[model samples]
Target: MIAVLTSGVALGVHVPGLLLASRLRERDVPVRVEVLERLLPPDRLAAVSASRDVFHRDFRVARVGQRIASDPVAAISADVQDELVRHWEECGVHTVVVFSGFWLSLVRRFMERTGRAPRVIVCHVDSVASPSFRKAGPALPGTEEIWLASRAGTALPWTIPVTREPPIQWDRREPRLLVHGGGWGMGTYRDRAADLVDAGHDIDLVVHAVEETGPAPGRTRHFVLNPAWHPWLDDGYPPLGHLLPGRSPADVSYTRGRTHHSSFDLARAVRAMVSKPGGGTLLDSLWSATPLVLLEPSGEHEGHNAQLWCDLGFGVRYEDWRSDAFSPRLLEKMHRALLSAAEGPRDLAAALSGSEVSLCSE
Candidate 1:
């Protein structure tokens, strides 16, 4: 059996593992997932549990303790070591696929003590310029690395995959836009939505915000928000009801109010996404061939991702969030880019395949 592992609350790390497990199950592959519980926030854990029915069938969940040291080669606690060993033996896991850098030391030790040293594959989900990739070096022998290159200029000695096209039918009716500010709500996007609404654009808006508590106008379903490391928004941002003007619900719908619904699934029908350049959301947009209307990135790594997005001609950036004019000329350009994305090759499955690991099929 194959085991997929991930740590931390970053959607970039967690969502990839979830998607991989789902893909494996779709192919009738036996798999299990292991997570480091202490590193994940409560909301992320809830998201993982919420997705269990759809993506985690026959998949077991295991938790390990958080690492106490900043060093990459630190030793794991006895409790964590024992739990992992039990999971490996019980599930008969012969190959380990990891999505986070934090688990590298633990995985290496586990392989050494178990004597059955499973094939280890590290899937780097972050941008090449990110600290995660820079610090990840001198990997144990027999370990392979897989990544999706953020920029053509950035090169790494690993398998770089193209974004995979999502396996969902598109609705070619009125174009729909998905508005999200990463996991935390972007207060500026509320104004951006108003600008679009005022333009008389015949489109549906699906907004994901932390302050929104219920459904609003334009078929906007309020998804419950998590703090998600955005302290300023959690502490100071006004409630959604106060920020957004009331309007009648639109005829269309995107999400059915599930808190843990996959963004990739939603992107299939969405013509464009207005979001911060978060790693997970960016990758999702690429795979769905959806155009991005990017807001200013939240961090240094996200800034690198934004540059790559522009370099690849995948999306356009809205530099000034305060600008009231939503240019029709810019919208046209975004639409053209969205159409162009579908013409390219997307080989995510081929990049993940390897000879050392066997994904069991029924």
Candidate 2:
């Protein structure tokens, strides 16, 4: 059996973990996906639940807090730890894929306690670890780290396939952009969405809160993520609902696909995605063949992700596209580039089944 671990904090991280687990299951690999947040005690969980409010109010300060709290300050619940040990033993687990950083310490301790060292894959979604994995200090001594992002213009097959849908042909895509901040609604995407609308573009604006206003008269349509919902709240996708402007909140309803996150549902129809280069966003852009018009990154790792995407011709910076008047030509070219990459014969999950060290390295 294989253990796939993820944290609920970063929806970006959790989604890939799910995608990998799903793929593993298709290969008849028995996989268990455990969310680390389940080990958090009440107080720690409360703090995590409220973190989005802090991030929304002032991202910079929230980021500073992230740096200070990177190291494990609270203990993993003893009960959950005991439960995990028993479960892993029962499952006969031989490998572990950790998507979130904090899980490393707990996983390392598990290896020590059981005197059974499962091969650990430290799966990094960013071009490099930051905020999350970087916060955890480093991997458990011998764990192999995998970069899901492209490196040095070399496409390493680590990007997980989000959907089986063929990349929507460029001409068939709606003349609209899917715009949102990744996971917790971090970054300048809302403002960028406004600018895109002002520039006379159709938009599927993903607003974190219903209160985030946009002009309803134009081609801008609102999609609201339940403000109270966070990744840890459930294993499923964000609670997303298409908004009918001027309707009461009760009228909006959330829906999701069985296999992929609902955001990918929105992504399938858009011409491009205007957002920060989050790992999940990149995965979505890559699979959907949607060109990314990247906004200013929220952190250095994301900045690197943005650069890697641009370097590989999968994306472009917001300013560059803006200066060019948001040409469909720019998007179409990147769309073709992404389609080529997505059509690759292999992906991270398939490579991992063979336990190929080369897949982990480059």
Candidate 3:
């Protein structure tokens, strides 16, 4: 059995773990996914829950909130930890994939208690050590890693596949952009949307809170992850829906996706993604063959992600796009570059399963 451990703190970390679990199950691997916050003591969980509101109100607060979640010594009861260990033992879990660094101490405890060393794969979703993995050196002893964005020590570099569908060709998509601040809705994207609209770009914008900002004619359409849904509260893929601003969520039309995530449903049809360079956004851009109009990154890791996208020609910085007058030709060139990069994406599931078959569309 393969245990995929995740945290509810951010979608960039959580979603990749879900995608990996999905792919492994496809290969008939017995998989179990555990949300780390679910194991926290009620008081600790409440504190984690309370952080979201403050974090949403300020982008800088995310770094602090994330630090709270990543504390290796965060309070999980001894009984709760043992219960998790026994569950994994009974599940016959032999390989554990770590998406958040906070889970490393748990994995270590499982080994010490059960005296079983499951193969540990620390999956890094960002181009550099993400918040969850910061200073993980002492925590991650003798673990193999899969770096989805960067080339790093003893790590197999990989690109996460977000969908089973092959990418839509460059000219096949409507000339619209999908813009959002990623899963948390914690970036400068809401502010950037005005600039795009002023520049005459048609876009689909995602807002973090339930703002009653209706769309502007000929410039924008609004979409959002169901405002009522929170990662800690719901284990399911985020309920994505077309936001009918000034109306309740019940009035919004939620998507039923073919895959675990619905964001890819919109992503594949758009010509480009305009947002912070979250690792998950990069994954979506790769699989959908959509270019990116990278915006102000939420943190240093995302800053590296934006730079990598620029270096690889998969995207351009938002300021650079502004300087270039938001050229459609630049996006087209990026789409072409993405299409080429999409061709040989390594399937992390297949690699882990020792299979020659690839999940990437042929």
Candidate 4:
């Protein structure tokens, strides 16, 4: 069986792991998932679990203490090493696919300690310029490395097969906008949502935030926030479409639609997504043929990702939420660009299937 290992810390990491695992299983490939529980809190873990039903049957949860070394190559703990071996034997894992670079050193050390260990495959999901790459050192001696690339880009020599899934079909009667700030909600994102509402855009807004708690602001009539973690606020915020000024009730009613839809589903229906430049988010947008109005990069890695998005002409970048770049003309241009790119297939899972090291192999 193939084994997929992930730190389970960031949604960016966990979401891709789920998608990969699900895709593998869909292909009738036996797979096991190992989650580093210590890196993720209970709520985030719950969010990850809620994303897929396969986790209950295929996941092997474990924990590791915080790293005490500056060099990532030497950062494996005794517990983590022991757990890896245990899973290898229990699951009969012949190939270890690591989603994050943090585990590369540990896997290498395990291989050295146990000469018969399974082959290692490092899937570089992080940006090439990220600190993770710097600390993980160069690729391990015999390990196969695969870089996940967008359709507009070319993969490296060690690239695995990458394919895009077909977009979901949704009934689109009116313009809709989906706004999110990655896993951890950002206050700035909420502020931006308020700005869009003030701009008098007659579109439905599906807001996903982790920290915010309150009713919808300003002229928003059909506001729905899925409290995936918060239990107290079980019922979503009340609808105040009538409170919206300068907009007719019929307009609010026409756009009033809210359900706990996944990003993939929302991408099919929404005009565009406003989010941070994250790997998982970017891939989802590309696969769904949805346009992205990316916020400013949070760091060097995201900056690099944003550059790629711009280069591919799949999305537009705005430095600030309040910028005039959110004009009607720009949004139309971005939407058209995304649709143009969506005409072709871009499937990462199909790429993996065609690889010499197919996950289905023993």
Give the higher-lDDT candidate: 1 or 3: 3
Ranking of candidates on TM-score, top first: 2, 3, 4, 1
Give the per-residue lDDT digits (tens) of candidate 1, residues 278-320. 7676666655666677876655666677777776666677653
Point out where model 1 deviates above 4 Å. 38-76, 129-138, 152-176, 184-221, 225-262, 320-325, 328-354, 357-362
lDDT tens string, model 2, 211-278? 77545759789988887776666666667888887887678898865677888988989988988888
Writing each residue's lDDT as its tens digit, candidate 4 over 139-199 gives 7766765655432346212222123445543334136666665543332455566667777
Error of 4 at 333 (Å): 3.5
Q: RMSD for all candidates, in order, please.
A: 9.8, 2.2, 3.5, 9.5
Q: State candidate 3's TM-score.
A: 0.91
Q: Which candidate comes out best when scored by lDDT?
A: 2
Pairs of colliding residues, candidate 2: none
Identify the superior model by TM-score, candidate 1 or candidate 3. 3
Descending-lDDT candidate ranking? 2, 3, 4, 1
lDDT of 1: 0.52
Per residue, candidate 3 scores C-alpha lDDT tens digits across 1-362 of 88998888788788888888888878888887888888877887777657766676687787655555447345888998999999998889988888888788889899999988888878788888887677444754567766777734322257666777788876678888888888878777877888778878888887655463455557577876776666666557887777654567557776645346888778889888988898888888888888888987878888888888888889998889889978889988988888877756467887877743322222
Residue 332, candidate 3: Cα error in Å is 0.8
How many pairs of residues in model 4 come into backbone collision? 10
What's the CA error at residue 356 for candidate 1, in Å? Answer: 3.8
Alpha carbon lDDT of each predicted model: 0.52, 0.79, 0.77, 0.53
